[model samples]
Target: MRPLQIGILNVMHDKAATNARFTKVLTHAGRPVALHFYYPKTHYPSGAPAEVAAILAPLDLAAAERMDGFVITGAPIEQLAFADVTYIAEVQALMAALAGRAVPQLYLCWGGMAALDYFYGIEKHLLPHKLFGVYRERRLAPAPLLAGLPDEFYAAHARYAEMDRGQIEADARLHLEATTASGELLLVDRPEANQTFMFAHLEYGREGLLHEYQREVTAHPERQYLRPAHYFTDPQTMSGPQFRWEETQHVFFDRWVDRVWAKREAKEVSA
Candidate 1:
């Protein structure tokens, strides 16, 4: 298979961890991939270094034009209103550029919510309780993203806000691919927009949730953060976390690469 170029926009606080998760699943996707990472102009975590002026900074749209596909990482600022977010405007601008380029994108968690709001006017509502756990998912539409995945499988969902199922169900613009038990949309495919919005963290490693839980507890001990659902082998004993979504994650990435390749070939032939 020919090598594909991917643009990864890191909007999260923990850049290293997110990059590691994506690299592990994508590197072995049965094709050679070259990843171009770009840090957003705003909303870096509290402890991150301040921005330094650069004459040679690679613009987001410039990067988009040179890539076959792009991925927007999940972030921790879901509770804030879209306008209230520090980098909301910057994100909107970048998304506009991606849309202008007609680049295929896979938006994760917070990224997904932001895209939904921007493109479809769909708003994210705060959950009464944090949706912190793994949940079962089933295919809703026959989309390329779910190419070889089973009819039923599990995925990790750790978010404080979610879109109303009614809004998703009513939207004819998207080809709804999968949903969780509670009718939360897990995967949405907007063929018209050429974007895939994912609510779960398929790229999470074996102990990803464990580390996340520990981090939250360490950061805010006064607030009782419930452990992730369906994560560990033994819930009562709080045993070691077991990874159950890697295979599906790999298949999804492979299929995404194939889809991007097909699009490139089609354009070449048409030209």
Candidate 2:
């Protein structure tokens, strides 16, 4: 079998770490996978450290279209208006290029929200505070992409904006796959478009939350930042992230790779 070609648009500041996390998850699917990392040319990270910038290739729609699957990673600029984001046009262009293609697209966190807004007119709302922590979510519906994931699972979330759950539920083209007890949107499936949108960070490493918290504290010491809940083994000491979600993360990605492979097979058979 040919290696699965997966392209990731890494928008995080820590490019190397994000690349490593996704690389580990995608390769665990028991297949030879080729990972391509890209950064938005319209809004390149001018402030990124030299090493981080070195690994990022400019976002190329033609190259992305050739991949078996594509992923758009989360960005910290969730609080900005969709139109206000500098790279919105570039992202929209890429989405348009792959709109009806068989290639599977996975949009994470802010990327998910952006896709929702762009495709379905589902708007995102700002929360009173950052929703930063490990949250427990219950599966709301069955999906091939979510196969093997338990009915209840945990994923990390660190964002200041959230999709309108009601909007998603009312839409005919979208399926609300999972949610928290409070009805926070966790997973949304648009199988018609061969796309999945995830609001939580299932790909975060063991120290992901810890490192994010430390950065927040350092960046804005005067403002109170919520320590990631259900993450640290000892909240008092802020030690041990407990690494509870690695298996779940792997299962989801493994299933995603399966989905991509199945799509390719069907397309080829039809052709």
Candidate 3:
């Protein structure tokens, strides 16, 4: 089969690091992939202008149906209303351009919130406090996507809001596929709607959280950012954060990539 063609609609201010983090995880997944970067021209108040950067690639809508899958990475504007997001108009247009295509889209973090809103009309509600930590969710069903994940596994989370579970469960097109023991929903998707939403950052490497913490602390020391939970090799002293989630990251990406590959082949078989 041809290398899986994945599209990244990146709106992160620090594009280089986000790109590298995703590359590392995907490369480690051991799947042959052809990545296409589409930088939207919309702006984020807290992020760098979605302006033209040498690294940003113009989106090729004509190639939508050819892609094995697409990914919409998270942004930092979760607190804003969807329509208020600077690029929502452009993103909506891009989604329209790809209408009728069945490419699987994986939405991460704020991107997940956006997808939940755009595709399923599901809204996100603010948490009492930012849900910033390493959280573990148990798989809720048997599906190809959950094929090799541990019964319960950890991943990094950095978000200020979560999907409205009542809306998600009541929507016929969506399904809540994973959740924490406390019953907080962690994963949801509308298979018929061709969308999957995940609130955590599965692509984060060992220091992703550390760097995030460092940056937040430097910018807003008054926020008194707590060190993420269950993330350190030694909390009392010494050493860096433990590399607890690397293997789990690998399994999740591997399964996801393989799922995309299977979709590509299945289409070919039917044709």
Candidate 4:
């Protein structure tokens, strides 16, 4: 049997470790995964612009025929119009490239915003209040990507912008997969196109949140974005919120590969 092919478009250098963990999860789930890194940070001493350029360059239509699934990582920059960001145009082009593709694709945070904007054609509103913390998001409907998830799940978040629930309801191209108690649309799943968009980070473990808090403190202390209460667990020990009814990290790749594998099997049968 051919190993499952997985491509990861990582935009942030800070998220390289998180993406690495995702690779490990896919490997542990018995799928051969290849991560294609796209780092846009110019400050890193060893960072390469050529690698970023390669991902942004153009997708080989033939290459897309081989990968089973793809995942796009989020960036820290947020704006009403995605075009305002330096690499926004390139990223949007990538999203557009993946449009109409049969393969399953999942996006996180800013990537979620990008997918929604590309597919639904709605811009994110500047949030009055910065949403920073661990919050409970209730799953709206059953989705193949979220097949095993309970109705209510916990996810980590750190953002200053959001999409209006009313607008999401009005948009026919998207479906509201989950919402918070205050009625904010948290998860939007597109079952037909084999696409999933999560506003919050499920792949982030307890330690990831802690590391983010520390990074925020060290890097942007003036912004004072670090909040202790929003974490899934405590900072020191990195355990105990038990919000999702599970201590383990959400292995999204496992679920993703399962869906893709089923699709491949069905395609083989049809052939």
Candidate number of the best lDDT: 2
Per-residue lDDT tens digits of candidate 4, residues 97-172? 5665576778878888878877777668878766766777676666555566655566667666786667778888
lDDT of 3 by residue, 154-213 (tens): 767777788898998888777788876666666776655567777777788888877777
Candidate 2, position 242, lDDT? 74
By summed lDDT, the worst window of 10 consecutive residues in model 4 runs over: 241-250
Clashing pairs in 4: 133-230, 134-230, 140-177
Q: What TM-score does structure 3 among the candidates reach?
A: 0.89
Please give the lDDT score for candidate 3. Answer: 0.74
RMSD of 3: 2.8
Best by TM-score: 2
Candidate 1: regions farther than 4 A off = 44-59
Query: Where does model 3 exceed 4 Å of error?
Result: 44-52, 236-239
Q: How many clashes in each candidate?
A: 1, 0, 0, 3
Ranking by lDDT: 2, 1, 3, 4
Q: On a 0 to 1 TM-score scale, where does candidate 1 land against the true structure?
A: 0.91
lDDT for each residue of candidate 2 in 1-271, tens digit (9 for 90 to 100): 7888889999886788999999988889788889999888878556545675689788889999998899999998999999899999999888777775657899999989999998889988999988888887888888666677777677788899999988888998899988766678788998778889988888988899888888889989999888998888899999888777777788888988888888888887998
TM per model? 0.91, 0.95, 0.89, 0.80
Candidate 1 lDDT by residue in tens digits, 138-212: 887787787777777788888899986678778888777888877887888886677989888888888878878
